[model samples]
Target chain A: MTAFQPDCAVVITREDFSQDALQAEIFACGGSAGALATFVGLVRGAGPNGVIEAIEVESYPGMTESSIAAIFEEAAQRWSLLAVRVVHRVGRLEAGEQIVYVGVSSLHRREAFAACEFIMDYLKTRAPLWKKELGTGGAWWVEARDTDTEAAERWGL
Target chain B: MKIDVLFFARIREQLGVSRLTAQVEQDITLEQLQLCLAEQHASHWSEVLGGENVVRAVNQVVAENDQVLAEGDEVAFYPPVTGG
Candidate 1:
């Protein structure tokens, strides 16, 4: 890896996250990296209830930011990452709206892939954010699935 | 001792308040505090916070019920997180 981006590439905002900005930041931070990996999470239109109207995300503000930063620090320790950026949305979001983005850059494709997945996994279980689905019957807080905990466990965290 | 209690997501909806300044007896474990709140607030609060799935966090870190508490600690109760 040639150049590394700034350490804190994480973002937590209610505003619609700009993919272009994420790309630019990663590229600018990891100009020397040979590979860059990206993942974007979106709100699905269909849920167990009727079609979803929107998703409302809530987080403990100070904890949310600090926890994301702490996770990035862990990813850095585990892999030779050049740059990373994570953006998560909060508040009411329409179906198809982008909910999260995880971008990582590394010298090789494998490291980048591993780090991206690792961060996403940890973020799910470790991050202090919650989701509620709004639809016909009413709004229901999205329940955390054991599958997510299993995913996080796969990382041995 | 005094502490700050916070509720989020489903817990917030159930409790109908975002934050509360609470006074408690000394050396209470987090679980004991939950019981105290439930007795004070009644059904919905007990039903939500009492559930096994509702997670407790002490000072922003996910913690066990046995975690000890001190004055001025920030405690949060919320449903299991659902975010990517």
Candidate 2:
């Protein structure tokens, strides 16, 4: 595995997160990393109405980046993390759009996979991003699922 | 002491305003501030912010109800996170 650059990109943009670009970022570090694990969250088209029209993501500006950075730091402490990249989109987005991207690099596949998953789990609850599902019926703000909170709890136990 | 209050997402929609300056004669806990806000408007304000799983933040960090507030603090209220 190669070294994870000391710099971790924690961005909350309205643009797309290119997988090819993210892959290049990890490889750019050279031989210090052997495993690059990535997770891409896409907006699902299927909803109760059969098609999700759009999903609006909201974030606490000043807190969003700092909170995600803290989550990444915790992941690094729990695992052997070489580098990390997290980019989340806010505002109105159409179905099938990429919602989030989480990439982690480590020396081994196991660590890389664990770190990536760990970061994702933490992001679900710890980050200050909120979601609102919109359709013909009107807009509904998404609530945190109990299953997600449970998933975060398991990490400590 | 005066503090800035911020709202987001559903809470913002319910309250009908995004940001407001709250005047506080004295320091108060986040819980107290929430109650004060609820009293300012109709009962729905309390129903939203005081609702279950509502999250609070002070100065851009997650905070508990017991956290004390100070002058010029930026406090935000919103629902539970639903991001991945």
Candidate 1 chain A, which ten residues in sequence have the lowest lDDT sum? A1-10
Residues A1-157, model 1: lDDT tens digits: 3233335577789998788888888888744688989999999988888889899999899888888888887787778788888999999999999999999988889989998999899878878888899987888888788888999999887
Question: Fraction of native contacts in model 2?
Answer: 0.89
lDDT of 2 by residue, A1-157 (tens): 2233334779999888898998788677565777899999988776765557899999888699998888776776677777788999998889899999999888889988988888788888778889888877777877678888898888971
Is model 1 an incorrect, acceptable, medium or high docking prediction? medium
Cα lDDT of model 2 by residue, B1-84, tens digit: 899999988889989999999887687999999888888888889789988878889999889999999999999998888887
Misplaced by over 4 Å in model 1 are: A1-6
Q: What's the residue-level lDDT of A141 in candidate 1?
A: 81
Taking the candidates one at a time, how many backbone clashes does each contain? 0, 9
Name the regions of candidate 2 deviating beyond 4 angstroms: A1-6
